[model samples]
Target chain A: MTWETVIGLETHVELATRTKIFCSCTTEFGSPPNTHCCPVCTGMPGALPVLNRRVLEFAVKAGLALNCSITRHSGFDRKNYFYPDLPKAYQISQLYLPIARNGRVDVRTQAGDKTIRIHELHMEEDAGKLAHDPATGLTRVDCNRCGVPLIEIVTQPDFRTAEEVTAYLEALKETLQYLGVSDCKMQEGSLRCDVNLSVRPAGSGELGTRTEMKNLGSFRAVARAIKYEAARQIQLIEGGGRVVQETRRWDEDRNASLPMRVKENAQDYRYFPEPDIPPIRLSEEYLDALRAAQPELAQAKRARYQREYGLPEYDCRMITSHRALARFFEALVELGVPPKQGANWIMGEVLGALSQRAMEPGDMKLTPPTLARLIALVGEGRLNRNTAVKVFEAVFDRDGDVDAYVRAHGLEQVNDDALVREACAEVLAVNPRSAADYRSGKEKAFGFLVGQVMRELKGRANPQRVNAILKELLMQ
Target chain B: MNITPELVERIADLSRLELGQEEVLETAAQLEQIAACMDILNRLDTRGIQPMSHVFPVENVLREDTVLPSQDRAELLACAPASDGETFLVPRAVE
Candidate 1:
């Protein structure tokens, strides 16, 4: 019997809001433990939580970008659970009425374009971090991340393969990044995903017993977990055993999943509406404002890049993957650089430099104007491509002055006619046989004379000017 | 949604409650009464009534995005059962 895998994702993205969702505490990451906490965020007795306006705006913006219908009436609920990280013992979430629902995102899979439906999106507060000290055998809780705003986007079980899930995730990440809702940094735990997977016969209409895996941190881990879990379930069924519905933890090191809890052991969350905060009722005017505020998403930007800038589809996709890179490209084009040149430089040199230094586009100190200036210098015959590349590296690495570095190193192209003439004269004197051969209609010898002139000028002489000057001197 | 002794025991375990034999019996009886009451409420035929999540008519209750300084570490951690200046210390959690 052929088994087909069915998968859905519940992704939690920490909003980029300046403050916590229900408190005035800063939402900055990597602060000293417990420093960003307040009475409200720490869940102190009698401390009330007031919703942060930015959280709602960001959530609505994300919903709009994802093609979700924003619910006019939504509210928060309390999911009661006992855990060390959750000091309140109840996480404020939305259950009865989520803020948005019925959204769809089109993702490119091996089977071609597939539309994945978003079940709902809700706002929630983040719990604290628990750090276990192996040496001391003690657990410490850091509440600095507590109360950080997050939006949980739940998708329907529309995926059949790992590739589809990954494509959906990538598309979702790009959309959120373009919307500026979240950093979507999986490494930093800014975006977390839990995948629910099951396997059934290929033509089976009903889903098989599903297992939920918590905290598959990276996309690769999600794909691997789905593949491993599906195989395990299929093998079990093939061996005359039934797949148990349970929650499992993906052991990244072991590259397998271990059962955490079964359905019988599942904790009943005992959800109830939170009375501290009122229901959220958004007006049509507010919805319109958010819709207008929505920026060009990655797909729209890709199409625009193709239509307006005449960029290739592949180039458009690569350039628009990161909002920062897309902005950098646009800035360069706006600074009078040709779109294709800007795309080539960014896709080649800029991306190469970032990868070489193990840096993100957001960490790049070289501004777009500075890069545009460098490209302009190269285009105006002031600097050869090689020297311009060196200048770009220096500027990118140290954030140094590009023009100053070029001037200090004398890396400018020697396009001066007199200087080229002098260099050509020296090369001709040194390579008399090559010059004689060039005058005698040996076209290949002309290239040798040009190379000699370039070497005499220490590669500073422009190749085009050198060719022209060498031919003129040889003809004379 | 039948309430059984086993179901009650599971709920107690999840809630981290240790119930004596008599206490479990009494709690089960009381839960049965509550379930009967919920059954009566469920039997009502208010077909068009909208499900309300909150009592108030207000929505979009939000505060401005501003940073307010948190309480001092000493003051806040003082309420904890155990703390070491920087973090709240708890019994070691085993995975």
Candidate 2:
């Protein structure tokens, strides 16, 4: 019998604000430890947190983009916990009343489109980073992240597979990034996910014991951990052993999860409404303005690209997967390259380079104009598609002028059809046997002739023109 | 809402605390009382009430991609309980 996996996620997105949530300290990452900390974040005596207005605006924008009903009244609560990372013994978080709820995100899985229900998205302060010293046997806590604003988007256990979980995360990240709530950079720790997964026998009504995987820093890791954990749980249960409820850490090196600690129940938090901070009353006008500021999210953008750009579903999905890449596509189109071709190149060469370097489109140094010029070269037939790829690589290397790169490399396309026919005729003269084969209905000879023409033109020949010239020469 | 001894131990475990027995019993009682008081929120019809996440609304607040100069090593090490010239020192770590 097949076992079904149940997956939920608690995604912590560090807001891309310049300052801390409750204090004016810089929300910068990778600084010297404790440098960004102040009296309020460090929980010194008599230091009161004055909430940053940007934090609230970002949260409302997030709520609106997530399709959540923005709360008119919400307040912070004190989640009582004693950990070294938390400078304040009790973290100021929302529990009894969260910011937004009942939102759903549509993710594309193999089973087709599935909507995952968002339980709630709550605002809270981040704890410090525990930088463990390997040489010295101590875990040092860096309080720089303390009091940094975070929106914890908790999802219901609506996903049934690792692929679905990944799709959901990709959709969520795109929405958050588009809304400008967070950088959504998993590598930079701006956006991170914790997956809760459990497995049960097929057709079982009762939920199985779940193991929570914490702080998966990448979408790939989340998918792998869920898949690994689901199989492990199923194997344990099928072997007549009970599945244990625990918190596991994914060791990417080992490609397996190890037990960190047992899972904690909700009552363990002892959550209480914070007395220091009062209830926040959001005005209708304020929410309306925030709604207006919310840009088209990834799904909506993908649909629009499919409809407006007349791109295939694959191209639309690839282009809209990254907001920066999608924006670049539109910018290139504005610069006169056709939308479909722009989408294709961005999906093909641009995404390929980024993936090879394990980088995001935002990390690209090549500007939209430079990419537009490259796309235009291909469109005008001044650079063959293959040569355009070389030009793209050159542009990436030097961040140089595209026109200069084309001129320096002598990489103009062989669009002179008469010249291409001459090269095809030479192939016909040299390879008389292949020419005879073509006359005898050997279709493979056509491919050989096209290759010979491309090789002769140093890949500068337009492939379609070469194919047409080869067909004409062979027929003669 | 009544925090029993069992509840206190469980919460201490969740909080990763090494509390004394007397403290556990006392804290559990306090937690129970607090939980009961907070339960008052349940009675109020919040069926359609939107939960607030933050108090203010600000957008597109970004910092420039600039790196400013920082303090010397000595200044930062002053905050550390123990430190070497370029790194913070601590007990010997295993693996």
Q: Lowest summed lDDT over 10 consecutive residues: which window, candidate 1 chain A? A: A259-268
TM-score for chain B of all predictions = 0.83, 0.66
List ranges where model 1 is wrong by over 4 Å: A134-136, A261-264, A398-401, A432-449, A471-476, B1-10, B25-43
Tell me how far the alpha carbon of residue A174 in candidate 2 is from the true structure, in angstroms, after superposition: 1.9
Q: Model 2, A74-142: lDDT tens per residue? A: 778998766666756789999887889889888888889988998999999998766667656676666
Which residue pairs overlap in candidate 2's backbone?
A57-B57, A57-B58, A71-B50, A74-B52, A99-B51, A137-B91, A137-B92, A137-B93
- Any residue pairs clashing in model 1, and if so which? none
For residues A1-476, what per-residue lDDT tens digits would candidate 1 score against the true structure?
A: 88899999999999999999999999998988988888897889999999999999999999888899999988899998877787888899999889999999999976899899999999999999998878678899889988999999999999999999999999999999988889999999999999999999999999999999986889999999999999999999999999887889999999999988444554689899999998888999999888887888888889999999899999998899899999999999899999999999999999999999899898899998888989999889998887788788888866767788888888889978999999889888988898788778888998788777878887887888887777777778
lDDT at position A66, candidate 2: 77
Chain A: TM-score in each model: 0.94, 0.85
Measured with DockQ on alpha carbons, how good is candidate 2? 0.15
